[model samples]
Structures are given as structure tokens and as C-alpha cells.
Target: MTNKLSAGLAALFSLGTGPALAAQPVDWQMGFQPAATEIMTQIRGFESYTLWFIVPITLLVLVLLIYVMVKFRAGANPNPSKTSHNSLIEVIWTLGPVVILLALAVPSFNLLTAQYSPPEADFTVKATGYQWYWGYEYQTDEELSFDSLLLQDGERADAGKEDLATYPRLLTVDNEFVVPVGKTVRVLVTAADVLHSFAMPAFGIKIDAVPGRLNETWFNAEAEGLYYGQCSELCGKDHAYMPIAIRVVAQDKFDAWLAAAADDVEAANRNLIAAIDADAKSVDVAANVKN
Candidate 1:
């Protein structure tokens, strides 16, 4: 037990120093982005659960097809048995699909229900999708509003986002949706013009934004980090340019930024980034010392 615990700590230290801890799409990544919310974790679990039945059923069908082709070929058997109505095979086929459906239905329905039925939200934020950018409004007594545009290459230095590895191109933005970590945030999404979708893979959220309708979703992020996402819907010519960035910070830092963001959103964002960067460096140094 002592050896196992030590090995686990060592593995965690290695992971802590890696870039995978940050929530973003890694290059050559095939699977879903690393889950940062409970909802996303459950979604990934359900995906794995469904794959078990899918793989075996696919392999079984393929094997049966090959057997039928080889065994009943013209060269093998000129007079193939004309037994198309086998009661046993028919009953097996009918019952097999029914059983599989039942097995899948229970868990699938449960997950769907849980997705829509969120707990009491801590606070609310309204996101309005425009032609090529997103605008966020904090639904509080002292409401704050701002538009987040894609960060151009030339503006990276001014915004203090020059590190491509940390602030990826096409995914970073001028301002991010800021929220306190470990708090449930309900998002009301809608479109100002054409249809759009607000999707964040880390949160397992993909809700449509209609012009005349309001759709809502909720997420509670357990980790503190900058999570990146892109507009999944094809709204217009510049649909690909619309990216979403959410910065989850500690409560104290979030409070400070929120207080200052009303006056100047850009300056507040830069200060928040610096604070987060300082926290990250401190963590790295502490981990190295322990090692």
C-alpha cells in the first residue's frame, strides 16, 4: 500500500507538470477533450458503456456475413438449402435487439434527464451569439457586459497571450467568460441574428441558440483553469472564427475581476491573467521542490 501510494503521487506530479491539465484541444487528439465538469465525466462514461455493445454486435454481424458467403457459395454448394424460415434464428434476432435496447434505454434516459434537470444554480450568465463573436452579460444586480472577439496574432503581445502553447491561436479570445471555480453557473444562450450553438466540450454542453428563443444549460466546473471551445454550428461565412473561452478562477480573484471589469473589461482581463499565471508558476515550483 505504501509503494502504491507513492507511485500514484509520482504519477500525479508528472501529470501536474504536463499541458494536458489545461482544458483545450490538443493537436492530433482523436477522443473528447479532457472533462473538467461532472456532466462531461458522466457523458464520457456513457459513451464507453455504449461502445461495448456496439463493438461486439458489429464483429458478430461481420463474422456471420463472411460465413454465409463462403459456406453457401456456388462452388461450395450448388443446391443451397432453401430454409429461410428458421423459428429459432428469427426468435433470437428479434429478442437480441429488444434486449440490447432495454439495456441501453435505462441509462440513456437517466443521463438525458440529468442533463436537463440541473440543480439550483449559484449565479446566471447570459450569452448572446452574434454573427462572428459572443457577448456575455452577468445576470446580477451589478450587471457587467462585454463582447469577446478572436485574438489576432498581432494583438497577442498587447493582451499578454503571446505563449501559443497556453493561449492557442483561433481559440483564444480578447475576453473570456469568467466564473468562480466549483460554482454552478447557469447560462442562458440565444442568437442575435442567425442560428448558432454554444458548445464547450469540457462541460459537455451543446445547446442551440435560436434567434427568437432562449435555451438554458448549467455547468459546475470543479477545476480552476482556462477552458477553450469553438462554435459548433455553421452560422455563416465566419462561423469558424467564433471561439469560446472560459476562465475559471478562485472566488476571491473572480470577485476582484468582477468589481473592476465594469469600468474596463480589457484591463481587468489582463490583471486576471497575470494572477492566474502567477498561481500556476507557484504550483510548478512547489511540485519541483517536493520531487
Candidate 2:
């Protein structure tokens, strides 16, 4: 009853936190979020590697444009030079592009190979894309499956997720796809109604979710946190609202949650959140004690 009143008051007053959640990007963040996996680390590295070539080439092109604008004006040269055929200049221009393209292509091809060549997965989960939500199935020995939906405004405080800094509005879901940290998680992706995409930027994973076909991707999250993604393919009007949230926890915590979720998912979620909160509180207390 008290929780309901708080949620209602929050909704009525449009109350929310000002700071951006960790799962969210800060204002004007130019690069990707800090990489959470090895693949994402390599992706960031490749981006920087390409920029080394891109920046110099862009500057060179700009300088050539300015030089042409100044040196080849009609007043400066009544006749444009018809001597446009120099073998050395032609060879340099042609070979320079070839060298640059070859330099870019080697790493590009290697990155593509790495993205496809995933190590053996420890376990598998099925993620089915719906019109505006995601359904996940833990293909473990117990095989528990559940549909995850966005948390409505009225259900905030009741779920113990009223803390906006942790569970930001719109990004928070009722049930998140839970996995164990430091374990390779394989996701079988497909769609039920229309074409959608399963994309998680932090893990450098993006794959198409076709209706009848199943696509596969894998990620090994090193740190534990609430990671967020969204449907990359436009399926319907509510595509923007379809959010993907994954909770990575310790193996023991995951085992406990998995065992409890087989009977009641909601209760299992509540217990899991309670455990996580307790863990956080313990860490805070430890820090204070050290101080």
C-alpha cells in the first residue's frame, strides 16, 4: 500500500532522478560505452586504428582543395595546365590508394573473422523478439522461460526499482535476461512477428532476428551490471519501446535465482534484487570501514 502510494505520487509529480544511469550514456558521449567484453575491446581498437588513416587522409584532401582553390583560379592562370599526364604523379596517386586500402582491409577482415569465430559456449539462451518486448528461455537442465516487458510507471516502487539512478525510466524492464558473469553466454535469436535485430553495443554484438530463421551470437561479460540494448530493426510503431536488459551476476547468485525462478519468476526476481542490494550495501560498508 505504501509502495503504491509512492509510485502514484512519483507518477503524478513526474519525479525522476537527474543523473544518468550507468546503463545509460551521458550527454554528448562521442564514443561507445566502455567495452564490457573482449570483442568490444577489439572493436574499439579497430575504430582507433582506422582513424589513424582516416584523419590524415581527410586533412590531406582538405589541404589539396584549398590549394586548388587558390592556385588554379582563372585570374592567376588564364590557361589551365593541359599537362595533366605525369607518370610519377599518376603512379603515386594510384598506388597510394591501393596501399591505403590494403592497409585498411587486412584489419577489417581480421575483425570480421573474430566476430564470427566464437569460442565454445558454456550454455545457451533463446531470445525471441516480439512486437515490443523480448522473451528469454534459459536452456539449462531446468529450462525456465519467461517474457520480459517494459516496466510501467505505476509498477516502479512495487518492484523495488524506484531508484532511478540504478533503474532508469524506459530502460528498466520487469524481467531481465540473467546470466552469470565470466561465463560464455550464447544467445539464439529469432523473431515471432516481424524482422528485428538483437544488438548490444558494449559486447559488440548485432545480429538480425528473422522470423523463421535463427541467428546466433555469443558474449562473455567480465563485470556484473545491468546492460541495456534495444531492437535495431524497425518492426513496428513501438519498436522504440522494446528494450533489452540483461543482468549479469555471480555464478552462485545465478544458480539461486535459476532454481527459484522455475516456480515463480516474480518472487525469484524479488529475491535476486534483494540479494544484489544486500551485496551493494555490504560493499559500501566495507568501503566506509576502510576509510
Candidate 3:
């Protein structure tokens, strides 16, 4: 046990201080959210505090259980103490739990407030969950919208051979939610059909997508990469089909993408208006000739 414990500690320390520490373990999808930024730091702090409370309490209980079984067995203690009503022990037990709870609640409450606190978000996105797909809208920006559907097996294979540098099958989407890194993005989640959950584990966000109700969550990704998640709630037969892919790009890339989306929406609207006007003009000319 001693050797095993020491070896485990050594391994943990080594990984924590490895040479490639600067490079996050995104390739393997192994590392925790890098808390170098303030928001992520708050999340990491909550996780660490919870672990601290859980680990020692679990160990202490396990050790005490083992010690009692081994040292105070039936044979060892033939005559057991029959005193069951001790006010002092009761008070200690009661107060001990209360004190431990207070210790946990203090930080837990603070973290909850921080997580739910609304910030002056840089952007807003409304994610609409469909039966087996997603639709995203740039709520605060131009009236741009897009539908994201899962790739079929053959489609995924072709994409892998052609667009390998982009993304993989289960993680890839027809449309990606693009955002600038280091910006607080407020995501308004809802469903168009059945119930689903918008969950991104790395961002530590999981909110239900209920029809006729909007759920909200926020995240500020400080690094640039493609993060993937799926519809967490079991909605229907193809619940697994709906996936969420977000691309966090550099500020410049994000700006470019935004401008492009805006331009596309504008062009589409202009073409639509022109077509309507041409139809109206042709109708008027035809009516004049008939008269």
C-alpha cells in the first residue's frame, strides 16, 4: 500500500510538471479546462474545493471502517459497550455535520452566484434543437441563421478523406458555432421539438432545451480550437444524431467570419427583394397592355 501510494503520487506530480505542460492535452482530449483565464479559474477552484472536501472525508470513513472491523471484531470485543445515548456525542455529531456543511456551502454558494451571474456579454446566440438537428442564430448581430445536421456514414467517410484537417465524423457538423476567443458568449438554448440538453463538458455547461422556454448559459473560451458536444437529453430515436460543434477562432478570424455571414445575409435579402420587385413590375406592365 505504501509503495503503491508513493508511485501514484509520483506519477501525478510528473504529469502536473511535465515538459509539455504548456501545451494542453487537447489532442488526447484529456486535460481539464485550462483555468489560465479568470472564468475558467473560478470553475477549477470550485472543482478543487469539492475534491478536497470529498477525498479526506472518504478516506477517513474508509480507514475508520476498516480499523473497526479488524481491531474491534466480535472475538476481540466479546463484551460490547451497550451505552447508546450520549448527549455529548450526539451534539458533536450534529455540530460536526453542520460545520462541515457550512464550510462547503460558503464556497458552493459563491461559485453558484458566479456561474449564474449575468455579464455584459459580447455576443448572444440562440440555439434551437430540432428532432435530429440544430439551428443557430446570431441573436445580437445580423439576422443570420443556419441549420446544422449530422453527416451520414458515407458523408462522414468522404469528409474524412477530403476534410481531415477540419473535424471528425461524430464531432463534425454542417454548421459550426463560431465565436471569438476570450469573449463572454451568452448562449440561449431552446428546442423546436422535444426536450434536449445543450451540454459541452469541457466548458462545464449543461442546460436543458425545453420547447417554449429559453435556457441560458455562458462561457468564455480563452483558447482557440474546435470543441464538440452532443444533445445530452434522450429525445428520440436519433437523439445521438444531433451534435454541437463550436469553433473558437482568433479575434481576427472571428471578425472575418462574422463579416462574411453578415454579407451573405444581406445579399440574400437583396436578391429576394429584387425578385419581388421584378414580379410586381411585370404584373403592372401586363395589366396596362391588357387595358
Candidate whose TM-score is highest: 1
Q: How do the residues 23-128 of candidate 1 rate in per-residue lDDT, one tens digit apiece?
A: 8888799889888899899999999999999999999999999999999999999988987698998999999999999999999999999999999998999999
Candidate 1, residue 235: the lDDT equals 93
Residue by residue across 1-291, what tens digits does model 3's lDDT show? 665666555544433222111222256664474553455577777788878879998998999899999888999999887987999979988998899899989988987898799688998999999998888899755667887787665765433323444455566665567777789999999999899999776676779999999999998876655567789999999997788877665576566566666667333323432333354455545444544
Q: Which pairs of residues collide in candidate 3? A: none
The lDDT values for all models are 0.88, 0.84, 0.70
**Of the pair 1 and 3, which is ahead by lDDT?**
1
C-alpha positional error of residue 216 in candidate 1 after TM-score superposition, expressed in Å? 0.6
TM-score attained by model 2: 0.91
Q: What is the C-alpha RMSD of each candidate to the true structure, in Å?
A: 2.9, 8.0, 16.5
C-alpha RMSD of candidate 1: 2.9
lDDT of 2 by residue, 246-283 (tens): 88888998999999999998999999989887766555
Backbone clashes under 3 angstroms, per model: 0, 0, 0
| Segments in model 1 whose C-alpha atoms lie over 4 Å from true places | 1-20, 288-291
